[model samples]
Target: MCSLFRCSSASSLLLAFGMAVVTASPVVMSIPISAQNAVPTLLTSTSKTTFSDIKANYWARPFIQAIVERNIIDGFADGTFRPDRPVKRAEFAVMLQKAFEQKRVRQLNAGGFKDVPPNYWAASAIKEAYETGFMPGYPANLFLPKQQVGKFEAIAALANGLGLTATAPASNILNGSYTDAPIIPNYAADAVAAATQANLVVNYPNVKKLDPLEPLTRASAAALLYQALVWQERVEPLPSNLKTANYIVADVNQNNQTPNDVVTVTASDSSFSILSSLLKTAGLAVILQHPNNSMTIFAPTDEAFANLPKGTLEWLQQPENRETLIRVLTYHVVPRKRQVSELSEGKLKTFAGKAVNIQVNSLTHQTTVNNAKILQSNIQASNGIIHAINQVLIPPNINLSKK
Candidate 1:
């Protein structure tokens, strides 16, 4: 058996179980390696599965573990998963070959690219990758197998190969989801948009930063492949972790139902009785019930309304106090849809024309709006997402006592 030291010493670029070096004759060669450049082992093998560099809290750990366990990719030979390491085109091809079993759509020239000789370790993988339509070569027959694959390119390839097409305009999806949308190459925009719609794109640390031109890291690759598998329905979905869930750009068209869904949920919930009634009285329910109007509501529980100053609710309910009631209700409503994960520490302009202060406690994992803690969140509705707060948010410049 080849020892780990000897395997790491080998000059091979990552020929793992998933990215294995293959011969033209199709014989699987066994290579003994540490986690660094070795064949990715399943979780069943305790000795080979643990990568020294991947911490329990690492954002990509779940994705990497999933990919490795399925023999889709692997770490290095030094017992460390250098997740940030860039993956070359050939390496990506090998990963695609292992990760997907899509039926072949078409076959290219058998002679293959001038750059990829038959003896090349990844030659077979590259051939399969292009022939299956997952990756296409450049004009003039250049595969550029050694070149590092960019994040957008990899996503585009996956989306194209999977026959996923953008349901909406490319510009609409890109501008809404990515902060660096302007930099996304025109050629890959549609495919990337399709990939985003399919939830195959995962950005870590910051979800809005697509870093389109950045080279795809091993961690990013694993995350992407995992999502692709999810889209293909080959594996069951993983449990939602904050680190991963917040970063997945779910389908933009997911909330297409009538706004009655929102109105019904709020009106039916006993906890939101106070909020639902106030909205109806203020006439904001008309707006919330309209399918064209997208909005977010920081609904205060009935208990929160009771905690308000005595006579506050009574004063607002009076016919003379209707205007004040509208203002107060609008204060809790913000334009457009926002999930709990989208809330950051900043001022968010409310429908009342005044902004509410948003405070996020990273250490405590709590979000507060105008000092009111979010007791429950991410209640999905047709028009938007609703969050339940512990207190009613008052608009600035409103004097409840005088009213």
Candidate 2:
């Protein structure tokens, strides 16, 4: 839905996504889904008989592992993940369908496909898969389940399944070429383009080329599935359990139903040094003291701080740029804490008082936060939670939030 930019190495991005890549912890602010939204109750798939026997070493291990963790896919009692075993068309269709339970189940006729008979075990899933455009038909109406799925076919299936596409920023077109143009099959141009724009497809060893149409390997499938979940907003690392040791603040009086906020966010204990410095510099310490005020703050990591335009931070440190800094900081916050589950597809308000329009796929964990990923989230706290954001937020209109 939105163009994606490669922000950092996997370790760096994973650190933001809760994989703990950083050593510096941020201050223990209020736990927030975005604002003081989510508090405690933390946060899908099913297994199929077709995958009766799967081994851990199978290339599908990662895909199976992720979907399994999310409850989207399951395994047999014996504990096996079959990677090379071709998925029966019906079975593959069902697995795909299960991954996107967010959309209303597509309506289905009694039967679907030439090979998928009425008695076929996967009729329902295949039908849903086809209707959703995840698995379109070939030149003929046949869906040959017995025959193994090819490479490009699978890519098309997944790209369509999650409704993801990509593009380049007008400003960053000169950054670098990331896909191989010729090898990408003609039919997959748009899909590849979409993937590239979304930062979904990265050239392996070469950013400017894509070996499109090649049979996607089992490992590749796992990588793609992980990306899809990231894209869909389904898979999020749970907020790190924080030790509530420092602040003496009392919890807000609890008369209200928790605000229906999206993106509950919290900061890392390790990032406290960086967090404190920014708060002091932004002159937001007073806001932290006010008990009645409800807020959401998107704090930048040390890396974000380091990358600021030269003298930019020093200028913001001046009185004239105070509002600019506040607007930048506020742009990171929303009114309430919203975990990935609560984000509706559309524009949302930020503390900076500007609007950030986004396209979200709640099922796949696919999210584009103004072209960046939430990376890490739901860090718990007392006042409001923090979501570690990648690119610094700079709302276009600082005055918008004031009114």
Candidate 3:
């Protein structure tokens, strides 16, 4: 459906694709020109090579390391992986050259792109990408090589290049799985659906919110590329235990599970009625609905609120006490998605700028957030994760006195 390079005629010719080591999905890793420290010793995939910025608990470490081990991407000279950086179109093209090895599917006049001069550094990569049917130029033969590529563009390229097609209608597939499905560009619907079917899409924090138009980040690009490699049978999949594995999008239609945003997830479930009401009253529920946000909510159950001291809930709901209510409610939220397995005996900073002490009983395998026991854990939503607790967690230094 992509208008690039006559999708109608080219789609037929490019439909036949052969797998190889390096293909362009999105450049999940890159070596910046300033990375003079990118030596073979530092960039190799061995255990000794580590990026300073990628921590043990970082969500994308496994994918990034996997790509690094394959020599598909490299870290910076400064030892920092800079996983948050936006990947450019040219960089993605270069990565495509190194990451996939599919035989040419269709030949395009790569030289027609005026932007990529003959001596441009990425000229060959762009040409290869175009000729191989991984990435093609714009309507005007414009390959905006330096532009920041969005997730939709990246996945579309991968799906197009791999000759992936959606078995179901793109709209149905997208609407069923993603909260932000309406915003997905019409041109990318089929490719996005195909990529989703192939499990080539990896969304961290929330699995259901595609955030399709967001600029592709380095770590995210790596995850996408890794999945593509796995699809091609060119690389081993990530260990099942890794947090990164949880982010990979499975075959939703086959799985028969449609994901919803955090607020919707809470509102639909009768158990969260008390907590859901409080979030709405405190004007915090809308925040959770944002497709781009990745948060974790430690929701206290309705019974938990019932367990509160007599008149305690009533007093907190007073309009005058709204600020205190906001603080207490926000104490249950962390700005990032954290799975149950990721929680340990430590302090987790909350959205209210306070920290909650976590205690995990090793032998009993029971977890406690502050004084509240974790009644339920790892209730996933499109924009966040949710863990139900047995009691409300009041932040420190909040004045509960009614006005």
Q: Which stretches of candidate 3 lie over 4 Å from their true place?
A: 1-29, 33-48, 257-403
**TM-score for every candidate vs. truth?**
0.53, 0.42, 0.54
Instruction: Tell me how candidate 3 scores on lDDT.
Output: 0.74
The clash count for each model shown is 7, 81, 10
True-structure RMSD for candidate 2 = 17.4
Top-scoring candidate (lDDT): 3
Tens-place lDDT per residue, model 3, 223-304, is 9888877765457678888777889887667455444677877887788898889888877665557655567799998999
Q: Give the candidate number with the greatest TM-score.
A: 3
Q: For candidate 2, lDDT tens digit of each residue in 1-403? A: 0001122354432222222211211111111111111222212014342344545434334444555544544443344443444434445565566555434324444445666676655666667777776776655667765454554566567765555432223123212333244454667655544443333442233334445545444434444545555443345422234121111111112123232121111222454345555555676554443333334455566666666666666666676566566566656766543444345678886644477766676465565567666666544333344556666665675432342
lDDT of each: 0.73, 0.47, 0.74
lDDT (tens digit, per residue) of candidate 1 on 190-215: 99988887789999878988999999
Worst 10 residues of 2 by lDDT: 25-34
- Determine the backbone clash count of candidate 1: 7
Q: Which 10 residues in a row give candidate 3 its minimum summed lDDT?
A: 12-21
Position 175, candidate 3: lDDT: 85
